[model samples]
Target: MKWSKSSRTLRRIFTKSSIGQNPTSKGKWGTSLTSHRNKLGTSRVISTELSPSSRRFTRRMPFHHNKSKKEPNGILHRSQAYVAFIDETFKGTKRVPRFMDDNNIVKGREAQRWIVDTALEMADAVRHTLGPKGMDMMLVDRMGNKVLTNDGATILKSLETKDPVASIIAEVAKSQEQNAFDGTTTCIVIMGELLRRADELISRGVHPNAIIKGYRMGLSQAIAWSEEISEEKEAYEAGVEAAKTAITGKSAEDFVDILSDICSRAAMVSSPSEMMLLTVHGKPEDAELIEGLVVLKGPATAGMPTKAAGNIALIESEMAPPQAQVSLTDPDQIKEIVAIQQAFLDEIVARLVKAEVKVVFCQKNIDSKMLQLLRKNDILAFRNVRRNDILKMVHALGGQLIADFADFSKSDMSAATVEVVESAVNDYVVVRGDGIKAASIVMPAPTEQSGEEFQRALEDAVGVSYLAVQNKKMVKGAGTIQAQMSYRLLSGEGCATADNSKVEAARRAFAEALLIIPQTLAESAGMDLMDVTVKLGNSPGLGVNVHDMVLEEMNVFEPLAVVQSAMSGAVENGVSLLRTHSIIMAKPIQEIFAEAERR
Candidate 1:
């Protein structure tokens, strides 16, 4: 519920936000307090204060009244204030109209200005990381670890902050990343602009409700425009170009053609959320897409064959030495115990060999003795495998996982193929079958750190490119779709069969906000913003050629679903922030006095 202009300022403080999100604190709390005294010499500061159980604010606004009897300037005599005309049973106390409490209050302009400005500053931080010519952000952690990349998700997640507003902005970035994985920077930019435009409207004597209404209308039209334009025509290699656009921001620029081909092939056999990301230590050009699962670990022994194609045995439990249960009082007893355990382990291997299983995947570590036995028998045993990877391998091969040696029989085996190839990078195992539904996009980097950056970029590109293929179309990129939506929204030529001039102020604000993407791209690339915007006329296929600085059709494209998702998330973030008239900070009793210990 919204509080009135004169309502008391928000009460209490807490470690959590209203959206139920917990931000990474970076070992610090982000809080700002403002206060002032009224002309009557009483404080009306906006800060935290202790309250008794009865005075604590609840979910509903608290009623503060009936503490005084006399009206101001003696306007009401005793008879008028008493109201003796009503019957005794019908009498009820009234809350007299009052200004903000002498203790707490937050004005509209003050709250709106700061929140909008803070959001804009965050947007600016990521603005330069958009489009082909965008630059990367070199993020250094507290331990002096360096990460150099232009991926929006990487940049936002790498830096942690304690401020509530920054936390909320992080949520916006996360939503964009999880939903589409493309257009994260675009979504954040639009959200900040929405708030910026909203602040201007509030300053221009417009009600917040009106601004909200107009924004909703504009958002609806933006989504509709995105859907209507659908996909760009497949004139020539459109799919390749769209995939390239998704990974163009310097992270994969050196070999986007090969990366695009690999991403497209991986998408054919993998689910969007289940796609695997594998990083190997080598050159960037060694990237490959396997139509199967990568265990991320190699065989247990170097003597084992690098390639194995036969019945597979998937072990879910550890393949280690026996766990001694009885205390040995003499050396003879200990020797007997060790001999018995060794025989039992040998029998398990013998069973696999009899079942014609040539390869084994152990979920847990394998003892060195067992590895030597498997190597001598020409069996490829992959040890220390992750549980998730084990599950994927079993599912891909259409086999059942056996947790115990007794439970593993001929029925548990499945026909499969596995390869342990050695490249300039580390050795990794690839498991495949006749009908596998998983795939891995492997990228080789000069160092482990750069490999991480490449993996991040591939993840973003894969999701968006897959979405475009699923939606059956794409829109011309390089600011083409946004420019069309802006013209349609502001010129009043679309969005209805009737006039929408009543909310023109809000609609105009939204339209101008759409241009920020193209304008920012131009300025970052050292080109004239006005010239770029003019070249990006109110046409569907018209977009700026970033390299040539000319206005023409480049056949560039991105998924429509990405744009729609970004718009939905950005608007939701902006509207929620706008509806917040005051922030109620809540803190626990212990934390209230946590600092006193240090004193």
Candidate 2:
């Protein structure tokens, strides 16, 4: 074959002939002759022909390249020019891979490890701040929103990263949130510290197994310590102390006595059968007194006495049964039940209209029908009386039962001469006639606008105070005798008196306070596990290794930007950093170390 190239195209020319003996063959292929033809000036082609059968047997091979393509599947390698350039400029080094890929990256579990380590390192950096004096974290979100908080869960949750391991740490924070409403911050700090310690252990070449064993032993002791600390007697004392601390911060003189009095009242009133009473309206000068402990549902009206003086009627229930117990399960049942209840309620209204009963309290539903009837009869019937209100009402009135259409003659009316004194400042009425002066309080209100604000404030104060005390004790590693007692008393599982409702409330408060310590410890330990293990044990040659060391190295391998990004992602996903810290921190250091040793 001969070929020639032109400006537009290339051309080829061929010359060949075959000769045969047969007449047809002789005419077309008998002669073996060669002919040269001009193709595009100088191009020539040599041709070889095959028979039809030969052609049918021939096959073409697929094309293959000797060298792999620089780019595969349209994806650029981490070492690619653009990637390397960007990484160098932003990361200040090209040693680390820019993207996740098999050749130049850690992915899957390995990637997760890197993330976990990085997060633990950050946690350790703040571990010292585990107590009430703990430090705060300043976080800036992707949108430039800034948050400053000492909450561990908040910090962990705020972290965003593509690393799966780091995400696991974030999960620890979530666990803490569920276990302990507070202490997320302490947990996170503890986790970070543990990891840091683990890294030191690793450097010392201590076997991971030994560290793991130690950690397990320590955890066992810690759990036992928690149990010991939370004894009932101790818990009560702690509760008293906590209350004193809170009150004293607000007032310095004999705050302990005042708190003790309040606690006594709580113990007395907190009963499932009765309402707890707390008085919160006192004269400005008497505000420091903090007396008249009654649990009422709503706030003191515009102007009311914070302290209750005089005798109190402690009614345990609503003065009347529900007009109806309407069942939503069946439509017909609802109407029939309501009608029946209304009929019974009408009789009670009739009696009240006769002026036999001055104030009436009821639990459960008071149908619209009953309301209209009572309004028409000029009988004030308050429905859904809270536990606190019941106690107060019972205290004020001598606990009498007025049934349907029961007419009290002049003698009966005069016999029960507790006059109702309406307070202009509070939502309760004081019963003061017949030389009987008593206050009525309520518990949870039926309506949203009724009494939630005061309840929430009290709950918050109690919850925070409890957490503070627990954190303090855990930091000291002291036996938690107080915590145990508080838990039993407050959880309503102990052998406490059943009648006094106030005592029950106090018990619950104590339990809440005792619960804070262990929860915080568990969360903080978990967080530190990954890092602490690494510090304590040398890298495992082949078997299981400490999570702490693993986490530390992983963090060292990851860039700060990745860490920050992962945290941001976590927060955007609605994961709370505070919660994450609590969970990670809650893991006992001993447990992690023990696991390491076993490995």
Backbone clash tally (model 2): 151
Q: lDDT of model 1 at residue 94?
A: 17
lDDT against the true structure, each candidate: 0.71, 0.35
Separate clash counts for every candidate: 7, 151
Model 2 agreement with the true structure over 1-599: per-residue lDDT tens digits: 22343332222222121111111111111221122222211111123233332221111111111123323433222221111011111211112212322233433432322333554555554443343323455678889877654445556777776544457666766665544333344345444434434334445554434433433333333344344433232433443444332232121223335433343233232321222333444322221211122322331122223222232222223334454433388888777776766667776566555555443445434556556665554444445556555554445444543333344432333223222234334444333345324322333233332233323223322433344334323211211222333333433332333343332332232233233333332234354433323322332111111223122221101111111222223222221221222122124689989999999
The sequence of per-residue lDDT tens digits that candidate 1 reaches over residues 170-225 is: 88898889888788899999998999889878888877777877888888988887
**Looking at candidate 1, what is the lDDT of residue 320?**
68
Evaluated against the true structure, the overall lDDT of model 2 is 0.35
List clashing residue pairs in candidate 1.
12-585, 13-585, 13-586, 13-587, 14-586, 14-587, 231-474
Candidate 1, after superposition: displacement of residue 511 in Å?
A: 1.7
lDDT for position 249 in model 2 = 15
lDDT of model 1, residue 341: 81
